[model samples]
Target: MNNLPVQWMAEQSQRGRHLCLILDSTAVPGIHQALLHQLTHEHYRSVYRETAVAALSVGGPFIFSIDSLNPSSLNELLEGQTRDWGWLASIENHSIAILVKHWRERLLIGKRPQQALYRFHDNRVLARALAHLPESAYPEYLGPVISACFWQGEQWATVDNPASGEYPVPDAAQWLATPAPVNQERAILLVNVGQYLLAEHSEDLARLPEALSPRAWLIAQLDLAQRWGWQTPEQLHFLVVERLRETHTPGIKNWEPRPEEHAQAHFERLRGERFPEVKTWR
Candidate 1:
């Protein structure tokens, strides 16, 4: 095993930071299984106390250590498998520090071919850091992690290869005009807005519910609006609806009746002749 930098280990230990070392087993086949065997041994238990080693891939190993290790010995162990193991030291509830062996060096879990070697406090910071790396390096799991960390208390979900058909965009006009309580309608609208935003931003939202919590959706909407320079929620809402309408009903021009027209007579017509269409649409 190659020795990790002693000075670095001592410095991190003095700061009482938890350590998370991510190793790419793909670089050295069977490295993850080998390391897992070693790290899980009772003899090495003390050294890797409170450690968690996850096989991010068949060969990739992501290790989290609650206590610091002897850098020299740790490196020596890592060297037995491969000289490409990545090290990260983080303080609980604080920030994470990445070891930059060199520019253009690859890490087990980093943005893909040319992974950026830098410290990040949390997923949000990491997301920004990932942006600097090649798109290939960006991991799928990190998307939800970034969203969850950046927007605390808000539910973050992923949609793998999202398309309009799987998670069809709700008809905004119909959604608003649904015979529901005002709050319920607003909730539905907000969720639709969030779905639209998620689709626009990343195709990952389709894996999640079409709608999350309304309050969280509102927060996300407000933040997105501010970021996109939209002045108001209504403005954002209109944009979302228009986009959905275009996607779902491309050939059909806006056939939704005006709000004023959705009165008693409108309900009667809907109840009578349009009952089948209305029921089918919902």
Candidate 2:
């Protein structure tokens, strides 16, 4: 594969608000150098480290790193910190799925797409999405709305024709009042399976319960490592799950509930009523 300029990645962040930088220990040292350079140029402050061990020392509104990520390290690193920070998996392409799974769990947070963003390697698609947002949400949204995968190319193609009914903005009021639209319908649920849940059982890596199965739950435990510029990992995961749910499952109606609307909480209650098993997993 052709090596793309890491400087370009940094420059992309310069044009936006807060930047989430992911540096692979496997990458050329210049990549790290470039990151420092760009961060300085933009006068951006960050939380940073060279290893996941070091990453534990930092806090949010910052950037950090790990020497390499593995299941054990991921479990440990994820458990160490509670302050939300961006995540980067610097492993090879073949292992992307493992990282994706870890990243996948981040979808189970608040009810806004504006909460998080994820990028496999580059921010082309994510940046485009941010550009479409209203100005009021910027800067404040910088950290949560952006994410980066350590290896995406600049020439990344837009996911043209994202499946229809992928992101539906439901009326806020209806979402708060009705539980049926969520429980009665086959909507995908999001669960925060991160430190809050896993910390309870560090010795056991429990498979997320299928409590919401038949219906799906977006899990955000390991996935929120990187807070997209304005979006959170949870929001990004929701988009991905929404697409997958729309494609793989047929005959299921979709619903979007805002946090202010308390749609997710109502649904959580409904989930308990219908699938009491949810209580066990969560």
Candidate 3:
């Protein structure tokens, strides 16, 4: 089985983090399935195995299982009271950012099982975020607030690309909103790079090298905030788009654009009033 050692499970023991293991033997076959099943056994650790909806109905430490995950499952996991997420070689592109935002919020609100999410694909990024844990509870919600704002802008690139959904584009104002947290210690303003570019003749405002590319703006934003005395805005996050190279039925591998490039391209296209360096990126 393609399993990491059982000791890796110790990461969840940290305060304010609950891990939910989503099970799908069909989604993952061969060694992946075998490893996950090992975790489910008595020798492994805490696990839950039910659909997201069913998982919500019970007390957590949820070893929840989902047959397949889509927007519907994403909504259930967030909207439902039991907020737990365990990734076993199965994290989808569309869902992760949104789920992370809410999980951060739940943690800020002093909710138990403060959500701990880890993906096998990008442990480095996860490690970095975890390293900057909030000293107080206020920024937990703010992180998502900032993250969701950036995610919407990134989504545009994918949805509007002809090779992508190629969906009709809408006014940026219609789709984007400021982070709505009550305590103003942290708030983010998402400027639509594309929208701003079309309106203004030049992109001088985004000329600075430090300005993050659109795809990676969220991470950059958080880093920028931390440097400039802005507390980590709860959970601001970034999203990007990537084309699928091959087709796998039932469950296909997901991908996203490189964040740093996305931020830079988007920024270069915008022409607007000078904005402060909101965050930084490593």
Stretches off by above 4 angstroms in model 2 are 1-20, 23-132, 143-196, 203-282
Per-residue lDDT over 182-222 for candidate 1, one digit per residue giving the tens place of the 0 to 100 score: 55334434543453344343333333346654345456645
Model 1's alpha-carbon lDDT is 0.35
Listed in order, each prediction's TM-score against the native is 0.27, 0.25, 0.20
lDDT pick, better of 1 and 2: 1
Pick out the ten consecutive residues of candidate 2 with the lowest summed lDDT: 157-166
Model 1 CA deviation exceeding 4 Å by range: 1-4, 29-31, 41-56, 66-69, 77-82, 93-282
lDDT of each: 0.35, 0.31, 0.26
**Shift in Å, residue 39, candidate 2:** 16
What TM-score quantifies how close candidate 3 is to the native fold? 0.20
- C-alpha RMSD for every candidate: 19.4, 17.1, 20.4
lDDT of 1 at 173: 15
Residue range 62-115, candidate 2, lDDT tens digits: 332332212242332223332122233222223323332332332222444323
